[model samples]
Target: MEFETKYITADIKLSEFKGNTFKTEVMFEHHILVWFISGETKIIQADGTYIFNAGDIFLIPRNQLATVINYPKDGLPHKAVAMHLTKQRLKDFYSRHKPAGRLQPLQKVYSFPKRPLLQSCLASLIPYFDLGKNLPAEIASIKIEEAISILRSIDKDVDGLLANFDEPGKINLTEFMERHFMFNMTLDRFGYLTGRSLATFRRDFKKAFNSTPQKWLTEKRLELAHYQIAEKKQKPVEVYIEAGFENLSHFSYAFKNHFGYSPNTLIGRQR
Candidate 1:
């Protein structure tokens, strides 16, 4: 049996997913504070990997790429509460209460495991999950504010991440694309993350790769998938999504078209 429940306001949510392991690649637009109630999560970023267990609290900074995999553990579903610290809310907060302390370099993810204060703040929302959309908006806002306050009190350098509101700067397109080719995102999103307009991204891409973005992305994804299937003996179903294809059928079609044979052919040969 499988089920999922979510009670979500604009800023806060309590979510539970049961049965199959779930995975996704995303770039968050707002900072996320998460409290795990059950199960486990593995988050892979460019910098490193992090695993969260039940009762663990963690903060994910915005504008960074990550692949998240959640699994059911000990017969409990992957369940957690997540709160969004939106840019506007943080601006207002910092304006009212000026942030002070030494600025630290940004880290990919912060783990605050078993903190009583944060646990209490997040646990208070459990009853509200049953309320669903009927949850009052002000209540959500207050809860987010409360979380921010608790973070500041517990971790002094958190202000460095929460108070700074800066958009992504221009980056080396080649390096960024090479590192993030496996994430399926829109061209506009890719362009924005690399600090370019769509037109400019296209132009720069053409100049650098002598190919269009779509063609280049497809070729790279397929190349990676080919390596996994042929050399690493991985199945198409296992590598499709991670290789950036949206679906198995699409991945199979593209693989056959590019390699002049089905992916299964390679798997069979390896076996």
Candidate 2:
């Protein structure tokens, strides 16, 4: 509500930018849950490419290493609303569920009434930025909630809206795996990020990549470790840490199972 930087559940915030196409990168480790109100964003990564057009909302989770190329880089011209959170947000979302309306499990997007509804939502948010500039924290939180209500009113699928709460993609699991391979990220986290129930996120993630997120994530980290020892300059222990592993033995075992060789052998062969 008041844009508290402290631990929050359903806080909403806005961002504005105008620019032309320029090579960009993502560094912040928090999952970037966003709705692109205008323009296009292109990302080139180790796997392939991702093109997100206007009217499309997507989730770019943590620890990804992709380059962003935004259209109209010079003029800038971009508007967005983002809700940032860590693992707890995802867990809390599903632990408490609703079955009454289409809003049962709030879609990572809440309910958007297609294109026109989204346009209006974006328009309504403009005043918050204006009001937020002047009001003190106490008053600002109330005003922001008012804005959130306005957003909900326009949503066609409001049946499943989470109480005082919050808030899609295709592509493949590898893309998700590369970006969000940490243990802290649970299935409920995926649902909260994508705006679905834990059940649905598990099903969808499995269908898209033909594997569960957990299994895929393990393979992804091990695969990346192989690449580093075989090609990149990172040492085995360093790559283990970089890939989010807490135990060197765990990394070693997974690496051997994945590539049929241990860290020591891989490093020895590289020499």
Task: Please name the candidate that would achieve the greatest TM-score relative to the true structure.
Answer: 1
Alpha-carbon lDDT, every model: 0.87, 0.55
Error in Å for residue 110 of model 2? 26
Any idea what lDDT model 1 has?
A: 0.87
Give the clash count for model 1. Answer: 0
Q: How high is the lDDT of residue 184 in model 1? A: 80
Q: Compose the digit string of candidate 2's lDDT tens values, residues 69-131.
A: 566433435555664534454345436543233644332323233556445544554465555
On residues 1-271, what C-alpha lDDT tens digit does candidate 1 reach at each position? Answer: 4656576576787778887788888899999999999999988776677999999999999988887889999988999999889999999899999886647537669889779989999999988877656578787778889999999998888999999898988999999998888878888988999999999999999988899999999999999999998888888998887788878999999999998999988888776
**Which residue ranges in model 1 land beyond 4 Å of their true spot?**
1-8, 19-21, 100-107, 131-139, 230-233
Q: How far out, in Å, is residue 22 in model 2?
A: 35
- In model 2, how large is the Cα lDDT of residue 105? 38
- RMSD score of candidate 2 (Å): 11.9
Q: How do the predictions measure up, each by TM-score? A: 0.85, 0.39
RMSD (Cα, Å) for all candidates, in order, is: 2.8, 11.9
Model 2 gets an lDDT of: 0.55
lDDT of 1 at 149: 96
